[model samples]
Target: MNAVAVIEAAVPASPREEWLNRGKNLGAERRDVDWRLADWLSEGKAAGHLDQAGFDFLADNLGIGPAKLKLIHKAAAIPTHLRDTSLTVEHHAHVAELPVQEQIELLTEAKRQHWSDDDLRKQTITRKVETGRAAMLSQEEWDDLSRMQFLHVWNRASVAAREDIAELVSQSHMRCIDA
Candidate 1:
């Protein structure tokens, strides 16, 4: 009897390291959201790119009472950085002048693991994906979750994707993740 053969490819280090290091030095959220939520939001607010209505729309989806919404609106608007899955706590730390090799480590690992943009987006939107280092969450976890739920309304995924969640199956168990 002959045994079946399989061919697998190996991933390199240079490109992955480069990607994890790239996309930095682009934010300036040190004043507002950078300290609280994200660097992009701080810059957005400071630059006058973030509008109150956009925040109002985001706040409306929060399901908080009208009174609380007013308070949030008065305090700070939703940071545009939250919109990107790649944005993480390290981004804020970078703005505040903090060292975060863990951030790099986690990102490198995620890249090596080949987590797709959707996978990273799922983690960000679900508040499950955080910077490798722990300090403070960028935004209200509920807010992120709620925003994801709201966006799902107009967004349509493939049948396979719909099953990706509802199927209650683990790819690792089927030689996906662990492989």
Candidate 2:
């Protein structure tokens, strides 16, 4: 046997080394596993297999930067059942802040529509606006108002539209206070 083969035979990979190898493989593939890796890392930490030092080691060795680490940590909030294998990590991250039911609904719709990350983001914003509007106005009042495209796309609204929204929100707040 060669010297490298003999050395490999003499020393086996430790648990941490094995875990790191698995993580590296998953990271390199870049599919269906952002959450999986996050879940494993978190489980390892919880099970006493990984401490802060170990986490730092993996982060350094695996090239997991702060942004990716944050995304992984956030994506972990999504339950395994809710995760779609076809979707990317960014897709899951977009809906991670939403409630579990909303998460499932949006993810289902996203998968059905083959939504990109931006599409999912716009949908999430629209959903939030609808929910917020529901809280601030009765169904009748909401229906009585003129339909404006700007209302559906707050992020792309013009300056005047923003002013109008601010005014409307303030008026709604005043009405609520008066009630």
What is the C-alpha local distance difference test score of candidate 2? 0.71
TM-score result, candidate 2: 0.49
Error of 1 at 129 (Å): 10
In the range 18-68, model 1's lDDT, one tens digit per residue, is 666563434434233323533444556678866767456645775444434
Candidate 1: worst-modelled 10 consecutive residues by lDDT: 90-99
Clashes in predicted model 2: 0
Clashing pairs in 2: none
Question: In the order shown, what is each candidate's alpha-carbon RMSD?
Answer: 19.0, 13.8
- For all predicted structures, in order, the TM-scores are 0.25, 0.49
Assess each prediction's global lDDT (C-alpha) against the native.
Answer: 0.44, 0.71
